[model samples]
Target: MLWLSCVDETAPALPAAWLIATDAQPANLPERSALRRSLACKVLARQFGLPDAAVEIGHEPAGRPLILAPQGSGLHLSLATRSGLVAIALAPRPVGVDVEQVAPASEPPLAMLHPEERRWLASLPASARPETFAQLWSAKEAYVKALGIGFARAPESFAVRLDGAGRFVVDGARNGGPASGFVRLTKNGGHESMAAAFIVLDQA
Candidate 1:
């Protein structure tokens, strides 16, 4: 099973969430996003009956979080955040999640697309750029994260292309298959007027 969640920034993490995050001293929003993501994993472990000390979150050489416990600890996790929401994804295999605020369309979507992808995006009506780019960016980020590699891999190296069937497909394979992707959109606030949030989930 794959599990994902979004939590408000003001909420404190569960007490046990601190065990593996004692060294963090977050001083900014981005830093807090990183810390909250780790704590979320601790909370998940505790929910599964693992003691505070029994479950620790550690990072691979590439900075992907991995469960550190007994050899059989059956949890795998990943996370990301946008504006005010922190998103988490858990599974029994490598997984990754990312959340991005969609309202303001922070950056130029064309800059992030692969050469081929850029052509496709250009063909769409100008009005559809933001939403489409949001999905592309989120899907690309999640794929890299799930591979346990960070930005060392260029977002453009692999493309999120489409088949004659018109379904999304990654350009290449990893871990014996293409990483699976999912995206969920939520309202920015109580209002439906602006950029909302998108949670991208990817798994091996």
Candidate 2:
């Protein structure tokens, strides 16, 4: 299951594997760190039936967050923050989540995408390109993060494209195939809009 909440709202009881997005942006780095820790603790406590104080957040050398105290819980998580929104994904296997603010751009940097993705973008009407680009970019970001390599692999090395039925698919990487997740566009109040994607990978 997936949950979306504002920072001031309470998180619903989530499943063992879930994804969450919050409109919680602290003003500074320290506050953001605290917010992440707090949210992780709450989610872990409920999911594992442990006391909140027993939950600890740690980082891999490459900077992915991990459960430190209850080390054998077999849970995986990924996070992304952008434009005042924070997204967290937890799962039994590897999971990745990314959120990007949607903004108009007359000429998006198509070179950063795989050649096939660029062609797909070029085929769309000019007016629709910006939102489409945001969706594709968020999906790619989430996919790479799920692999735990981040940009260590070039963005151009793989493609996230729409199939004929309008579903997103990942292609061109070693593990490239049908992507097992979704990209969604969300409206935050009146003026702010965001695109977020959640991906679950079979292999770690």
Candidate 3:
């Protein structure tokens, strides 16, 4: 199953189980993202009828969080957050998700894009580039994370095609597999376009 959750980062009310799960996570962890992840696990476990305590969270050497409870269950999940929004994807196979918010003043490194991607962006008007950059970047990140290698898996090693607005298809993967996405223009404070990508990898 696939799930996407938009958690309000305003310290909103949480279920008692989730609160305990969140508190059980390491304190003074330094990154607020970690807390959000813990909460995400609790939320996901609830949906699966697994008690929060039955879930054990560990980490890969590459720093990716490993959901360690109920071993051999063949379940996997991924989480992403940005600007007070948390996105999660759950699947029976490996999965990855990414949330990217556009900023007009953004200056992204060109090295992140493959040559074909660079050309695609160059073809767009300057006004379209920033959000497109975020969209493309998020898709690549999502794909690599789904592979469970994180950034250690080179995103540029494969290719992804942006199929118009808010859609991505993995170009080089077997028969061009598709990745799901959600995109919208937000006027929260300033005009910005944000996107979320959910990716499932090819079987090993």
Best by TM-score: 2
Kindly list the per-residue Cα lDDT of model 1 for residues 85-164, writing each as its tens digit.
44556555666666554544344457657888898888877777666676667667766776778667888787775433
lDDT of each: 0.54, 0.72, 0.60
lDDT of 2 by residue, 81-160 (tens): 66556677777777778877777755779999999889989999988888888888888998888888898989999888
Q: What TM-score, computed on C-alpha atoms, does each candidate reach?
A: 0.68, 0.81, 0.73
Model 3 lDDT per residue over 26-141, tens place = 33444546755666766656665676777776767766556787676566667665654455665666677776777668665557788888888888888888888887887888
Model 3, runs deviating above 4 Å: 1-3, 6-29, 174-193
Query: Positional deviation of 192 in candidate 2, in angstroms?
Result: 1.2
Candidate 1 residue 108 Cα shift, in angstroms, is 2.4
Give stretches of model 2 more than 4 Å off.
Answer: 1-34, 163-167, 176-178, 189-191
| Candidate 1 weakest ten by summed lDDT | 12-21
Candidate 1 colliding pairs: 103-195
How much does candidate 2 score in TM-score?
0.81
Candidate 3 similarity to native, TM-score = 0.73
List per-candidate RMSD values in Å. Answer: 7.2, 3.5, 6.7
After superposition, which runs of candidate 1 have C-alpha atoms over 4 Å from their true positions? 1-30, 50-54, 69-71, 103-107, 162-168, 188-204
Worst 10 residues of 2 by lDDT: 10-19
**Model 1, residue 103: displacement in angstroms?**
4.3
